[model samples]
Target: MSDFIGDWYALLVLLLAGFLPNEVWRMLGLWLGGGVDEESELLVWVRAVATAILAGVIAQILVLPPGALASIPPSLRYGAVAVGLMVFIVAKRSILAGVICGELVMLIGKWWLG
Candidate 1:
């Protein structure tokens, strides 16, 4: 009984410690940004910057992959990204489709090459 209570107590503490703080900021952002126009110049610039940052991160991962990803070969990595992008466009910009397709291509390429 004590062990059960201790386990739940630890879980509650962990949840509060990790989740509540992030949620507070997210809720605050939602409230503050409620009046912002999506088509405004500021939002457009923010979107572009976010996209650029995401592209940079992806490029870094492909060019200088870490751990097991490094063993997959650059050609496969590039091919995955290309195929993923194509699928993303073809699937009406579905992020899930693109990500899954890219991951599948990478895994299949690695398996076949080895």
Candidate 2:
């Protein structure tokens, strides 16, 4: 414990390194955007870009899933997306419900098709 504590510089470096990566951006945002308007054009553009990034990530995972997901049938994947979309529409675009239904479809598919 004494030896470990003696490495204070290393611990400080580790703490700074870990905190600086993502937290710095968040801190900078708070500093620079003290009075950000939700309906502002720039904010709207940011939201659009964020949504695009989220959609792109989802699409990438669905299209080229790794490991176990890769073994799942393509038909299963398509059907899951269809069911999710339907649920999303019917549920008035509840993303949570849509994702749950999609995941449920995939889970059922794996079990039934096994």
Give one digit per residue, the lDDT tens place, for model 2 in 11-103.
Answer: 788779877776987997889885777689988898899999999998888789878889998889989999999999999999999999999
Looking at candidate 2, what is the lDDT of residue 9?
A: 82
Judging by lDDT against the true structure, name the best candidate: 1
- Give lDDT per model, in order: 0.90, 0.89
Q: What TM-score against the true fold does each predicted structure earn?
A: 0.60, 0.66
lDDT of 1 by residue, 16-99 (tens): 998897799679779887687769998799889989999999899899999988888899999998999999999999999999
Model 2 regions lying over 4 Å from their true place: 1-21, 92-97
lDDT of 1: 0.90
Clashing pairs in 2: none
